[model samples]
Target: MNKLSSAIWFRQEQDTLILEIHVQPRASRNQIVGVENDRLKLRITDAPVQGKGNEGIIRFLAKEFRVPKSYLTILAGARSRNKRIAVRSPRVYPDWMTGSIQRALFKIS
Candidate 1:
């Protein structure tokens, strides 16, 4: 089986860490919900309209990862619920992401 529901891969062209997200638009809250059966499920605050949910993902992720919103960019899937977010962190490495995801999941109420 594939390891990831949405692939989080490195894009050499963009020089950033890319994440393919399975967005739950119009969710009750904004959070990096968890990795459920391998899929990364995100609960977003904004409803799925006019790119609000997509933007919410960026903002939520940026805050969760302790990075500036400017470090995140939606690389694709603007209209679709599934999205690709590029996280730019020069001082961090791939291993850091695992901890970030874990912490986000644990912190959720």
Candidate 2:
């Protein structure tokens, strides 16, 4: 594991990257707000009702990572503000995930 892979919020298992995230629903826009309490904080526009928030999260992440929605999976916390997501074979890494994280991902790919 590299530096980012050892962090509380991120990890890598073979071709998949796993993220521990904290979500804020019903925000003005969807955005990644950095890390808070060892989790990746995200502001989502959709309300957390009947999985809309979860769907929004998947959409946002898929766009960020340059992957299809089918390549991402909500591994846990589907009904809560905190979630564990798996991104399989991401084609791009968002700007926020810079430095060692990017280096590590590149090495793996």
Candidate 3:
């Protein structure tokens, strides 16, 4: 979970859960890998060029969580693959949302 370039809980205005994500842009596909000591590993089908990876991240999560991309915003690290995503708009996440979110972004190790 630590490898995650970014992780955050929805509607937690204070003491919110946040993670640092490391995106493997232009991966063969989209998947999530579990915590490996420090960083969260993520694989995306979109190419790393032109913010595709970043866009893909939002798309993937929106689909998985059945939310709109507008609901999920990249708070930081837009230019860089490592980003801080904040779950907003919807204000609610599904059960096991974190695990599902990770899986949506990376492959299980």
Candidate 4:
């Protein structure tokens, strides 16, 4: 298993990192809610139409991970709420993410 295998929300893919997200589009604000079943629950203000929400997701991820927008890509589920995205060369991983990962590991062990 990979270093992040204990966590469900994301995993390292070679140099890049992959995020499994459950997006709540048209939300009042954009933010990361929590982790569930190995997926990160994200709330975004944009509606899920014409890829607007998808764009918002990329922007949010870029800022959160401290990477450029171009570094993030929608790997799958562009239209669906459940999305798999890849982020290249991230410079940050917030405490909430590491806490979640620890909780997941605690649950496993």
Candidate 4 residue-wise lDDT, 5-107, digit = tens = 4376777878898989889999999987776566888899999889899999998989888999999999999879999999998898766577655766688
lDDT of 3 at 70: 77
Best by lDDT: 2
After superposition, which runs of candidate 2 have C-alpha atoms over 4 Å from their true positions? 1-6, 100-109
Each candidate structure's count of clashing pairs: 0, 0, 19, 1
Ranking by TM-score: 2, 4, 1, 3
Find the candidate with the highest TM-score and give its number: 2
**TM-score for each prediction?**
0.65, 0.86, 0.63, 0.84
- Candidate 3, residues 2-94, lDDT tens digits: the string is 433333322244533344556787778887654433444567889877777788988976775576787777778888866767655444454
Candidate 2, which ten residues in sequence have the lowest lDDT sum?
1-10
Better of 1 and 2 by lDDT: 2
Kindly provide the TM-score of model 3 when superposed on the true structure, using C-alpha atoms: 0.63
lDDT of 1 by residue, 11-103 (tens): 334556666567888877776665444446677879988777877888887776668889988878888866677888734443425665454
Query: Which segments of model 4 are wrong by more than 4 Å?
Result: 1-6, 101-109
Give the clashing pairs for model 2. Answer: none
What C-alpha RMSD separates each model from the true structure? 7.7, 4.5, 7.4, 4.7
lDDT of each: 0.65, 0.86, 0.62, 0.83
Q: How far out, in Å, is residue 17 in model 4?
A: 0.8
